[model samples]
Target: MARRSDDAEQLLLPYPTTRRQRLEHLAHRAGGIARRVLRFVLRWLARILLPLLCAAALLQAFPYQATVQGVPFEVQGSLFTRPGLTADTTLGSWEFPDVSGVPFGVHVRPEDVDVLELTRLAGRDLPGFVEELRVDFAAEVPRIAWWLVAELVVGLAVGLAIAIALEMAVRHLRGRPRREHEVRQRLLQFGAAALVTLVVAAYGVLSYNENWVRESRLTGTLAAAQLFPGQLSSYYTEQSKAFDVLGSVVGIQAALQADIDDERTPDTAVRIMTISDMHLAATYPLVAQYAANYDVDLIVNAGDESAFGTSAEFTPEYRQAIADLAATTPMVWVAGNHDSPATVAIMRGIPGVTVLGTKTAVEDGFAVGAGVVEAFGLTIAGLPDPRVYGGPGAYGADAPDVVDPLQRAAVREALGMDDDEDGATDGGAADGENGGDGGAADGGAEGDPAGVDLFVLHEPAAADEVRELLPGQVRQTVSGHTHRQNASDELQDDDAAIELVEGTTGAGGLDNIVRGTERPPIAFSIESVSADCQFTRIVRFSIESAGPAADLGTDPATPQAYGDDVTVSTVYFRPQDVAEGRRCDTDLGVGAERPWADAG
Candidate 1:
């Protein structure tokens, strides 16, 4: 035993006596230390990483079930920090279908949805549908909250299981552990599991506070607060505010309908409602309501009916909404800057919708040629905005030098417009693309210069060139891109005419829904024309939410729930009014209020 101990001591010695022996021994000891460090690092890494991986895998694989609005929804939660709520459908993915105020993603797969039931509820009434969604989502909040807690608990338990198993397996592989070593080993395993759990919790908290809460409307109110308790309240507040905003829209529509019902139309007057920048289908109901209530002879849309003008914007919901609106009345539209060729084509596919300055493509799913059109005992010529997409996936405006002559020829051919009054128009009937001639202008039968009554286009800037082509023929120009209502004599010149611009009818679409109380108002213009094709009057309508709808209880008979006022102004064009340059609402003299303003 003594001899063995001596040999072990000799082997374990720090250095040797001889120079060669000492050098060799030092090199071996350094290698031993490196090996030990490498093993130690690798073992620690496995201890930490294995538990985290196991926990993440377990959490992600779990299915969370939530029922909203009497609809069963199987939502899958992922630890992605994009703060998105992606709802899958047959058409494609809809991002943030209802609300997206969570740090991580929550996906509602297509198979889990009951499309028919959802459609039935939403199609019944928009405001009521939104309110139900808010209520049901709020009711489901506890389930979601508990799921979040479970994620943490599950993660910790999984980490602990992995750590304990690893420690036991290592002990078994290396033989029995000493009492002290076993206690230390157990402590190390517990520490690794706890560390992993802590890291995950910290990441979640940071992500929640950073991505979800910060982007909410209650950012100011909850910025200094912790994630729990406050976040739940913030979600409820945001949803309530969203519902109120939508309710305010319904309120605006109701107000507009009331005014339309009260208006007494003159026998010789033809009324038309002008609206534009309906970035999505949100305002289609408003437009339909106006047409239904008012005996609107026609509807002139200044365009931007889609948000990005992408094919994705043509969801079945949007298509159905526009189709229903189209069934209400005749609509003439000019494509706006945001409108792609696909957008124009979709509009063309719908009957009773006439698109200007563009030909119907195969994608339109209809026959071609629908540019120039006549409506309401008037020669109306319209041109699409220059900045619209030329083709699918292609962007940029068509060159003026290229499209100008084409539009002029189409206008002349359609109206029999004699540019030089030399008994000849610019061209014959336009071939199958620009629309066949809509007969001669009203006065063309009498050997007079065929003139256009209204020149409709998307941009006021582009109207100048088309106005120059028509000379004194155009009675009025209508456009909407500025998202502000305006009736101006700016284009009123020897060769031009007065112009009216309608504000955005969709209140900036879905993008502004989460904008926190500063969304744009819904607006439109009512233009009346006499039988003589003379522009007579324009009534502008505008209203915005002052704040959330007043909580006047749950009574359905309460009309005072809306807190905002609908501002309506009428500007008339008479020989005397035009002579004095009182052609715009801003130029209305004191006595101008005699007619429509004080009727109530």
Candidate 2:
């Protein structure tokens, strides 16, 4: 009886404990539970999330790429039928047009319009997932912001239904006892409901874009009808595409190549300006007068020196006439593939004016010899005007290997279709006497010569030969080999050296004599490079180097409309002044077409 009593006493008595001891035990139990739960969740997530992440990454690498369509859509709040909306652009701000009437009648009418900058950057330009992210919330959507809130409310209502269902299932399962089968069944049901919710969310987004969004917004009746030619569908399908192609073309009418320096005053510096590739004859007085209007301290031009770079339209007298006009401004000349350099030399020598590039001259801050110019402030190295890209019959895509699409088109057009129709292939046509009865010569493009690659090759000098001439002296340079109007102003630098293609004074008409209804239609580059102002303003006539990946075919008829290379004052200002959107109401300030080439 005594032993039994003692045992009961011991069992009832509690052990003495400090606060520290109690905390230790509690911590040990909590750590074990936490570790076990984390491991289980991680394991399950790894099984699903790993695969999902991998798939998402792979899809990003190969996202879909497509050009945007031309279907125009617009959204204007109900503000159309207002009163007194005179067609004036001077004082109309986007938030408030200069009209008054109904509080809610200012809606934009949708019509067919060519669109750009619409397509999102995706696997095409960025990762699919990343592209889908709306990084820019600034984009103005017509309607749907507040509506989305209501729509989200509706989504939550459906979620509440799922939650209620789950509550019912839980109550049913727990009413009696804990069953393993019941827990498993509830988990599966929860997953299915979650998936349905995700699907609905995606559907809502798609519905919003497909049904409630727009691409264009115009107000006038004439604007909508004229903008959307050939029914809305066809305009969306075809005309939009036509305009896009027009954007890629660099139409240059006034292409003058000169050696210039940006020291404000010329003559003070030995920088020589060499002009080339101007279809000057086509527009005659307009181009000449335009040149005369610009600053013409000295004008030394390379051959072709005519409207036709290789066209044999003018005889020897034509070359003489070219020299006489240039002499008015103490201009010099050199051989271009267009005329016989020997004959040109004799004619230009008449005024005691030196024939440049055939023999280097010590002027314009550099020494400009025959086929070369040597200046001090600048080493304006250049290739002989005759050193062209793709020799004789080899001007197009398949001609010994120039396969750029634009180049291919240019070569084909240079050679008349009726003439070279003898054999046509998907690749490209042969130049077959393309040089206008001059027995087409076929030298590949004036590429890097053996040792001509210089440290800084300016002015389309033989890329290879320049290296041999001044490999180390070149730090940064510019050149004009592509004949791409505003090539540099447009920032079409395919390489280094801060080099710019000689670029165009005029960007209009047939580039590379490409397939166009017009032949040698005049275009000129009124490009300017100012060091004092630290600006390069390119004022093209019909041609311009529009903004990057820009479309030049958009007509100026539309308000807030922008075109590619074929618009006047279609200016390409660069460096910094251009960034400021500087405009020249008259003087056009200092540029190739204004200060340098002007006969004044």
Candidate 3:
């Protein structure tokens, strides 16, 4: 046995570990037992820690008390540290009640807001009064990540490589030929290589270098802040909420731009309802109901009053029938690309609806609602039929109107626009599988361009084109193809011509929309409030016809003067009733064109 021990010793190198090492290994085993006891306690701590974290998350997700008691311009922008800060706690009296578990209140002072607007912004609804400042946890991430990642990778690589190398070297020196010993040596070698690989792959290559990071992180600190209620903010938000609700419930938010000059301003009280793209046979009842009962002095059919476009989509009797539907009311009809010239002729022949499509002299005028004498005040001219890519889906025009005349003409020519033998417009050919017959591409008319009070068409781009074609001459433009109501506040003034959209008032989604919204889902687009089956009271207003309206304090019933002090008190038309359940249902819309999923 002694000789065998010597042989074992001989197998090891000169500086190999001796019998003393076994004693040290025993000491290490004792230390390991103590570590396991420590680990058992840590495991219990970790279990409790997870539940505490869950409770914290729950508390964070629950909404806190919201006290809106101060100003209309509440804290919408970034808070704190940005100046123009009003004195803190400049009280107009702020208070709040506790909410479900969470609490918050009127955290803004009166000095922080505009005084006159205080009444509008302050909270009438106070739900809480607790303020727990959370350190917007997202802000801490970049700082911790800053130079540390690369450095961490380097340190980890160096330390792990050394640890693994030491294990392998120690194994070799001991000359341990045990199966477990050789396995341990090979594992250490692999771990060393993996460490080097991870450092280079993750940190050295993937991480953004110091200079690039600095350029990107210039203003991250500017974004972080805690949310709390303020007086002016609350008041403004409440007013906005009130307007949004009333506007939505009232149905005008879809296409009526009433109160063009804000209620705050003493302007003419004008209520307008415009409907376009009335695909007559399909959604006539919905349009008729809106037109017959809604509180609109001016009801307009922008264009495509019928789906009578070419020989295929149009039947002369159907055209006459659709035109007859509007014969009862003083309807103003424009031509869509879909309407054939024959369909247009039938429309012009209709007694009640004055067709403003073919460009004629000053005497051959059209209707633009109630007032507006030809040549002096308002004028209506018909636009040529718009070009189509074989059918409707083939064409795609999205940019702003082309400015240069030569460029515009070239575009028209490229689209296959040319005059027919009778000098009438012969439609051009379209490009691609989606192309259509192109004719109305450049929005020019057949006769003298009398200054129109408004230009009407089927698409919004048509108005933009007419404006581009005539520069300053065309004042107001109305269009509809979306089969939805859209009104413009930006496009009106004294000598102001605005664009109005009145289409598919409440036929929900007759225009490719799987789901519609009361609030605009996209940032750039306006939210449309759908018209319900109720009687809508639209106040017809003539520009500058009456004196400024009285500030009757948010009361719709308050009698007020029109601009120029006209005492025109119109009667309220009664509203229709709802279909079945409570409010209007626009989401799960179904039916012919709606289910077909394409626009006119």
Each prediction's Cα lDDT score?
0.53, 0.32, 0.34
Q: Which stretches of candidate 2 lie over 4 Å from their true place?
A: 1-275, 278-284, 296-302, 306-324, 328-333, 350-354, 359-379, 385-521, 529-535, 543-600
**Candidate closer to the true structure by lDDT (higher is better), 1 or 2:** 1
| Candidate 1 off by > 4 Å | 1-266, 359-370, 389-425, 428-450, 487-496, 510-518, 545-563, 575-600
Native-to-model Cα distance after best TM-score fit, residue 454 in candidate 2, in Å: 13
Q: Give the per-residue lDDT of model 1 (tens digit) for 323-345.
A: 78767666878777667678887
Sliding window of 10 residues with minimal summed lDDT for model 1: 589-598
Please report how far candidate 3 places residue 412 from its true position, in Å.
Answer: 10
* TM-score against truth, every candidate: 0.42, 0.33, 0.33
Tens digits of lDDT, candidate 2, 233-324: 33333435543322211000011001112232222211123344543332222334344555433443433443333435456554454555
Task: Point out the worst 10-residue segment of candidate 3 by lDDT.
Answer: 218-227
A best-first ranking of the candidates according to their lDDT comes to 1, 3, 2
lDDT of 3 by residue, 497-597 (tens): 34555444223222233335331110001111223222222222111212112332321111121111111111122222222221212222211110000
- Superior by TM-score: candidate 1 or candidate 2: 1
In model 2, the worst 10-residue window by lDDT is 248-257
RMSD (CA, Å), candidate 2 to true, equals 21.9
